[model samples]
Target: MKLGLVIDLDTCVGCHACAVACKQWNTSGTTGPLTDYDPYGENPAGVWFNRIRSYEVDDYPNNKTVNTPMSCMHCDDAACVTVCPTGASYKREEDGIVLVDQSKCMGCNLCAWACPYGARELDEDSGVMKKCTLCVDRIYDEALPVEERQPACVMTCPTSARFFGDFDDPNSEVSTLVRERSGYAMMPEVGYNPVNKYLPPRQRPKAPTIEKKEAATGQTLIGKWMKRQKDAFNDFGKGAR
Candidate 1:
């Protein structure tokens, strides 16, 4: 099954909740105790499986802010796996999840450089690479409730902006969302065929403009006050000129 995520960019609020949840769950999970260096220092840094970045689209007045949460894409043609000299980086044939074998990793940094999405990070503490495992340990556990079997990020998203499902199934929620919302994969030109899809923000309806009426012969107090303020502003501009 081609399992992956469908992230609704329109709904993401840049809260970084998903990132925090991923870090919290994975820290003690299959890849426990992710490294953190100088966390409280001026240059705080750490390894994280997910990251949220916000960008403003268009110019000031008409601009929109887009919040993007990124992680391993689990691509069909995963360059990271192909570039790993040691057979440490591999994709699961059953679920399409890309995982790095910490034992086989030699801290070569080759896979990191080869990955276009910057999803892999070197754990200086372990001297190996790590990435998003799609919470494999949690998802496959029969002990956990089926509803709670999704990735930590997907489970903790406050806005419900994230979705996890099998993308190969035509009727799957992920696939249906992609078809209906015109969801797209990032950097498709890179030819990795990333399984993760992003749903673009929906178009907003424009507000109806109020038609201006002719000023009445007798003005109300508020209108007169507004007129006075407008005249003062015009006078100030004239004086400045």
Candidate 2:
């Protein structure tokens, strides 16, 4: 069975809770320190297991707000694994989580460059490239005693926006969710065959227009001046910034 993540962009709310939770768990758990440089200072950069990025799409009157939480796609044809020269990065055939054996890592950044999505990050402290392991520690921990073990992001998400499961199973919740919600993969053109999927945003009602009403009003001196100013900026580039 191929395991993966299903992210709901519509319900994400631009919250970085998942990223924070992943960092916390990975740093304190089985994984090593998620180093930070000048964290509270001017330039801050660190190795993060996950990142939440915002984007504006569908311009004009029908604009849309999107908050995309991204991590390792754990692609079926993972480029990171294929490019690793030290046998550090490997794709688990059982679960499809691309992981790095820190012990074997030689601080080479080749895998990070090969990844199209920029999932893997280089840790300055350890001198190794790191990426999300899909919470392997929690999933296999006997102490937790969970009915179904899942990633920290999936487990800690307050809105239940993140889902973790085997995508290959036709009966699985992840599969059913993908089919029902019309979920889609990001940047299908890149063709890494990402395992993670994002549900399309809910369509909004068209905005009402009052152009005709405004046009009916007799042009005042101020309106003429405004028109001349707009023309100056648009046509003549006089007041353009």
Candidate 3:
């Protein structure tokens, strides 16, 4: 099965919930304890499997914000896997989830450099590459409830903006959304053929405008009051001068 995610850009509110959930679950998971460097210090940095980036379209009143929660794309033509000198990085044929074998990883940073999506990060403490595994360990656990087997990001999205499923199945929810919503892959020009797709924000309907009536025959109370106030201010300014 081609397992992956379909993220709805329309509903995502730029909340870091998915990223936080991914970090929390993966920290103690099969591939982690994602390391932090000087976490409480001046230059705090850490390895994270998922991250959120927001972009603004247009300007001012008409501007719209797009929040993109990104992770390893699990590409069909994964450069990270190919560039690994020690074969530490590999994509599983069974599910198409890209993972790094920490045991064989030599911290060469080649995979990180090779990835166009910037999905992989080196564990500063462990000296190994780490990335999103699509929560492989969690998804395949027979002991867990089937509903809870999805990736942590998909589980914790409060807006239900994230979806996890078999992308290869044409009838799957992810595939259906892709077909109906014109979901698209990021950086297609890079040619990684990323598995995960993003559903673009739906077009907002324009608000109905009210046609302005012609000027009233006489100045209204508020308008007349404003005129009197302006004259008073002008007279006061002249007296002061």
- Would you estimate the TM-scores of all the predictions? 0.85, 0.85, 0.84
Which is better, 1 or 3, measured by lDDT?
A: 1
Question: Quick one: best lDDT, which candidate?
Answer: 1
Pairs of colliding residues, candidate 2? none
In order, candidate lDDTs are 0.90, 0.84, 0.90
The residue pairs found clashing in candidate 3 are none
Better of 2 and 3 by lDDT: 3
Cα lDDT of model 3 by residue, 1-241, tens digit: 9999999999999899999999999999999888888879998899899989987766433557799999999999999889899999999989999999899999999999989888999998998999998999899999999899999999999999999999989999999999999999999999999999999999987556443222222267666666676556445434343
Q: lDDT for model 1, please.
A: 0.90
**lDDT digits (tens) for residues 34-147 of candidate 2:** 888778988888889899988667544465668989999999888899989999999998878889999999988999998888899999888988898888888878888586
Ten contiguous residues with the weakest lDDT in model 2: 209-218
Once superposed on the true structure, which residue ranges of model 3 sit more than 4 Å away at CA? Answer: 207-241
Question: For model 1, how does the per-residue alpha-carbon lDDT over 24-126 read when each residue is reduced to its tens digit?
Answer: 9999988767779878899879899998898777643356789999999999999999999999999999999999988899999999998889899999988
- Steric collisions counted per model: 0, 0, 0
Q: What shift in Å separates residue 171 of candidate 3 from its native position after superposition?
A: 0.4
Estimate candidate 2's alpha-carbon lDDT, on a 0 to 1 scale. Answer: 0.84
